[model samples]
Each structure stands twice: as C-alpha cells, then as structure tokens.
Target: MLAGKVSLKTVRSFVLHVFVLAFSCLMIYPVLWMLSSSLKEGNEIFVNAHKLIPSVWTFSNYAEGFKGYSGQSFMVFLKNSFIVTISSVLGTVLSCTVVAYGFARISFKGAAFFFGCMMMTMMLPAEVLTIPQYIFFHKIGWVNTFAPLIIPSFFGTAFFIFLVVQFLRGLPAELDESARVDGCGHGGILFRILLPLLVPVLITVSIFKFYWTWDDFFSPLLYLTKPEMATVALALKNMSDNTFGTSWGMVFAMSIVSLAPVFLIFIALQKYIVEGISTTGMKG
Candidate 1:
C-alpha cells in the first residue's frame, strides 16, 4: 500500500510538469510562429501557417524592409527610437527618484494631500490628456519635433513615482536619522546613501520606460510627420498597404528587428524587476 501511494505521487508530479510545459509552449507559440514566418518566403507564410519551419528560408525580407520608404533607410527609424527611448528612460529615472525621496522621506506641508493627488492621476486614463497635451506642445512649437515626444518625461511619471515611493517606505527611517547625525543634508543623504541601494528599483523603472517608449506608435505618428523623423513603430505601420499589396514578409522581418532590443533588455534586467516589486510591500 505504501509503495502504491509513492507511485501515485510520482505520476501526479509527472502530469503537473507535462501540463505546465504544454501551457508555456502554448503561450509562446505566437512568437515562435512570427519568427518562423519572418524567415519564410512570401507565398509560404500563409500557406504553411501551421508549420514552424520553412522548407526554403529567405533573408531577402530583411533586406527589402531595410530599404524603407522614400530615400531613408530603416536604420534611421531605429536610431530615432533609440534616442527617444534612452532620453525618456534617463529623465524618468532622475525625476521619479527625486520626487519619491520627497514623498517617502521628507515631510512637508500638504504632503498627504499632494501624494493623494498624484495617486489619483495614476488612475486617470492617458487618452483624456492627449488633446490638451497636443495643443500645449503645438503652441510651444514642439510639434514636428522630438521635444513633444521626449520632454514631458522629465516631469515625474506618477506610476514610477509611486513605485519608488513604495520601495523607499519599506526602508528604515533610522537611515535618514543616521545620515543627519553624520552632517549629511537631504540631498547628500539621498545621493551618497540611498542612491546605491536604489539600484534594483531604478533598473525596474528604466526597463519599463525603455519598453513603453520603444513600443510607442501614436505619439510619433502625431508629432513626426516627416519620413526622416519617423520612429520604428511608425515606420512599421507604414509598411502595411490595404489599397495595394502589403509585403507580409518584410513586415514580419522588421517586426522581429523591432522587438529585439525590448526582449534583450527585459531578459537582462528581469531579476531586478522581480526583486524590486516583491520587496515594495514589505513595510509600506
């Protein structure tokens, strides 16, 4: 009877493992299919949609996609994406860290009220703000320029601010008292002490900022009307042709290229994301 019980346990574990593995494969099947389609010849893509491998792989799709619209190459769009994404990430890190330190450490007049206001903004839908934002940027002559796409990031994003605030609240207030005893001012304490410890959460913020900015299509489409100024997302959108024939192969190839940076950054920094978010609610 004991031996039979052991055998039953082993079978249950085996079944559980098989179920999880199958589910994981199902979740990733679309990505696998896209990668496979990117390598396939145009005619074979839809015809062999069920197949994961191509009989005849063609790299010409990437070449054709890179040719780009007008005279510019796809490299131009990629460069634009990098510039905006990197700048936005830097701005978010700087602004969010500073604002979070204030909310988490330094007590001030109306601090609770202001923090509540900031939290309310987090619940606000982004679409509600777009029209007014566009008008404001247009008035400032920021339309048709990278300024519209990049400048507002310097103001703290509510989500990142809240994230950092939660992480900071989890730390002991004694650190601030000790720093003050050592003749460190608020700025000095934040820069010299807390900054180092903030690495995990900061990396989390940077990864999120990079991912969102890289994938943003609407902002670029609204601001960057010039072909030379188009970002990777906008350029990919332009690749689709409804009136004529869209090049499915080229679209799939460039889609693969566009996803590469986001995938690499997330994979590299994912551990920090897990660490930062997990520890956030420990105290706060």
Candidate 2:
C-alpha cells in the first residue's frame, strides 16, 4: 500500500514537472526569438523567420541605439527613466507601506469602511480617471512636467497599499506588543521592528513599482511635451516613428537592453515574492 502511494506521488510530480517545462518553453520562446531577431540584420529577419540562429549576428544595431537616434539620445532617455523609476519606487514604497500599516495594524473608527473604499479604487480602471487626472494636473499647472509623475506617489498607490497591508497583517502581533512594552511608539515599532521583518514584501513592492513606473509610456506621453523630458519608454516609441529609414537593428537592440534590468530584479526576488504573498492569507 505504501509503495503504491509513493509511486502515485512520483507520477504526479513527474507530470507537474513536464507541464511546468512545457509552459516555461512557451513563455521563453518569444524572448529567445526576439533576441535573435534583434541581432539579425533588418533584411535577414523577414527572410529567416524560422532560423534559431541569425545567419550573421551584427552588433551594429545595438551600437547605433546606444549612440543615439534622430534628435533624442538613448543615454539621456535612460537617465530620465532611471530618475522617474527610482523616485517613484521610493515614494510609492514609503508612502504605501506607511498607509498600509495604518489600515493593517492600527484601530480607528471607520477603519474597515475606509479600507474598503481604498480597495474599491483598484476595481476602477485607470482609463476612467485618466482625463480627470489630466484636467486636475492642468489646473494645478503641473502639465508637461515630472510633477504629475512624482507627486501622486506621495499619496500612496492603492494596489501597493493593498499588497503591503496583506503581508503586514500576516506578521505576528507579539512584535508590536513587545515594542510597546519597550516604550516604543507606533513609528518606532514600524521603522525598527516591523520594517525589518517586512523585507520580502518591501522588495516585492520595489520590484513591481520599479518595473511598472519604468515602462510607463502613457503618463509621460500625456505630460511631457519637450523632447528633453521624454522617458525611455516614450523615447523608444518616438524613436521608431521619427527615424524613417533608420536601422531597425538599433530599435531591437535598445529593446533588449531595456528589458534586462527588470528581468534581473524579478528573478532575484521571486522567492521572496512567493513567500510574502502566500503567507498573507493565514490569520495566525
């Protein structure tokens, strides 16, 4: 009977592995194809769609992309992307984490009702509020600037707050009580004790916020009128359109380069993400 059970478990594990491998290939194939296409000359790509190996891999496209395209410089756009991504990530993490603590740990009148409203904000799509945000920013003279990009992060984003609140609620209550016994206020407990334990969730939030803000095109497109203010995402979009008869190689090269950082960060923190997200559902 035990042998039969063991055999069944092994079979189940094998099937799961096979399924995972198949799905992994399905997901990874496109990335592999894109990398190959990016390295291939523009003319050869259409001709050799099935080729796993580029007939002749040329670094020229990537080289040109880095050097600059048309009027916009890739380096400048990269710098702008870094600034927007880093600033927004920091702002969102700090603001969202603190607000989440308020909802998760603190007891106040109407707290549950207000938290429900906060969650409802996520249910509404951003498209519904896009025009309203644009008009509000316009009235405040924040149009065509980074203020629209940076300031909203200070108030705290709904999704990030929700994620963090879940994770914070999962942590043991003993730590908060211990801090209280030590004469530490809520701020000290949050900053000193809880924050240390919340590392996994924090990293998870940072990874997500960084990637989303980095790749964000619409917000920058709506607000940034000047070419100098263009971010990496918008720069990529405009670079393709503006550079007529320009090298497609450079475009692909820049795309690959842009994709690398987010990929690395996600892979590094995937384990923490799984743990932090999973533990949230258990009340104890």
Candidate 3:
C-alpha cells in the first residue's frame, strides 16, 4: 500500500511538472517571437508574421538604435537605471528592517494601531496617491530629478516592514532573552543577534525592491522631464514615432539588456529569498 501511494505521488508530481512546463512555454513564446522579429528587417516583420525565419538577419538595428538617440545613449539609460535601482534597494532594506524590528520587538503605546495603519497603506491603490504625491514633490522642488525616482525609498516601506515583522515574530524569543541576560541592550541584541539571523528576509526584501525599482515607469514619467533621465521602461515607451519606421529589432536587444541584471541578481540571491519566506511564521 505504501509503495502504491509513493507511485501515485510520483505520477502527480510528473503531471504538475508537465503542466508547469507547458505554461512556461506559453509565457516565453511572445518574448521569443519578439526576439526573432527584432532580427528581421523592418519590412519583413509585418509582411511575414507566418514566417518563422527572418528574411535577412541584421545586427544593424541594435547599432542604429544606439545611434538613434542624440543626447541619451543606451549606455547612459542603463547607468541611470542601475543608480536608481541600487540606491532604492539599499534605502528600502535599511529603512524596512529597522522599522520591522521596531514593530516586532518594541512594546510601546498604540503599536498595534500604528501597524494597522501601515497595512492600510498596502490596501491603497497607487493611483489614489500618485497625483497627490506628484504635487507634494512639486512643492518640495523634487520634479525633473532623480530625487523623485529614488528618494521615496529612504522612508521605510510598509509592506517590507510587515513581511519582516512576521518573519521576526516567528524567530525564537529565547535568543533575545539570553542576549538581555548577558547585559546586551536592545540595539546590541538587534545588531548582533537578530539582524544576523534575519539575513534571509533582508535578502528577500532587497531583491523585491531592486526588481520593482528597476522596472518602475509611472514615477519616472511623472518626475523626470529630461530625455536623459528616462529609465529602461520609459525608453521602451518612447521608442518609435513612425508607424512603419519603428526599430523592433533594437527594442528587443535593449529589452534583453535591461532584464539581464534582474535575472543575475535573482539567481545569485534566490536561495536566501526562498529560505526567508519558508522561515516566516515558524519562530516559537
């Protein structure tokens, strides 16, 4: 009976894998098509949607796209994206972890109420605050600058804090108690004992923030006016003016370049991310 059950589980697992693989193919198909299309001539793309092979493969589209911009090179857009993403990730991690520790460890007045308010921010749509946030930034002279794209991250993000708090709560309290008994202050205990153990969750938050900031467009559109200030997303949006003159090939090449960093970051740090999520709500 046990052997039969094991065989049944194996079959179920295989079925699930097949389903997942099929779904993955469906999702990846458009990307593959875009890449293939990018290699073909501008005329060939519309002329031959049914044709899988390019009429003529050319790397010139990518070259021409690079030369397409007058003041802003693709390289510069890449650099600007990296700057915004890295700074925002660092800011979010620092602010979120500290705030999470406060909510998880401290027992001050109105703590629960304040935490509820934090959660409420998550429920609010970005559209609701977009205009007001733009206005507020305008008042503070942040428009048309990296400050608008990158500065909001310095303030602790509510979602990251909440995620961290849950993970922290699941951590064993005895560690904190032992640290306290050894004459360690809250700050010391947090720095020496807690933060070190919270590495998984910290990594998770960093990865999420990095990806989101790298891909965000609305804020950049609202905040940055200069063509040089465009992120990868904005660059893609402002790609082509001529209905027939659009360089789909270069667009594909640039997109792949844009996604490369995110893929690398995730692969390098994915272990910590999964570990952090797995450990959440398990602390006794």
185-272: candidate 2 lDDT, tens digit per residue: 9899899999988887888788777878888999999998788888888877876884555566677788888898877876787775
Instruction: Report the CA-based lDDT of candidate 3 relative to the real structure.
Output: 0.80
- lDDT for position 198 in model 2: 84
The regions of model 2 sitting more than 4 angstroms off are 1-26, 273-284
lDDT of each: 0.87, 0.83, 0.80
Write model 3 residue lDDT over 219-261, tens digit each, in one string.
Answer: 8888877778877777777775454356777777677777788
Top lDDT hit:
1
What are the per-residue Cα lDDT tens digits for candidate 1 across 80-153?
A: 99999999999999999999999999999999999999999987999999999999988988887899888889
- Against the hidden reference, what TM-scores do the models get? 0.91, 0.85, 0.84
| Clashing pairs in model 3, backbone N/Cα/C closer than 3 A | 38-249, 170-283
* lDDT of prediction 1: 0.87
TM-score of 3: 0.84
Candidate 1 vs 3: which has more TM-score:
1
Instruction: Give the distance in Å from residue 79's predicted Cα in candidate 3 to where it truly belongs.
Output: 1.0
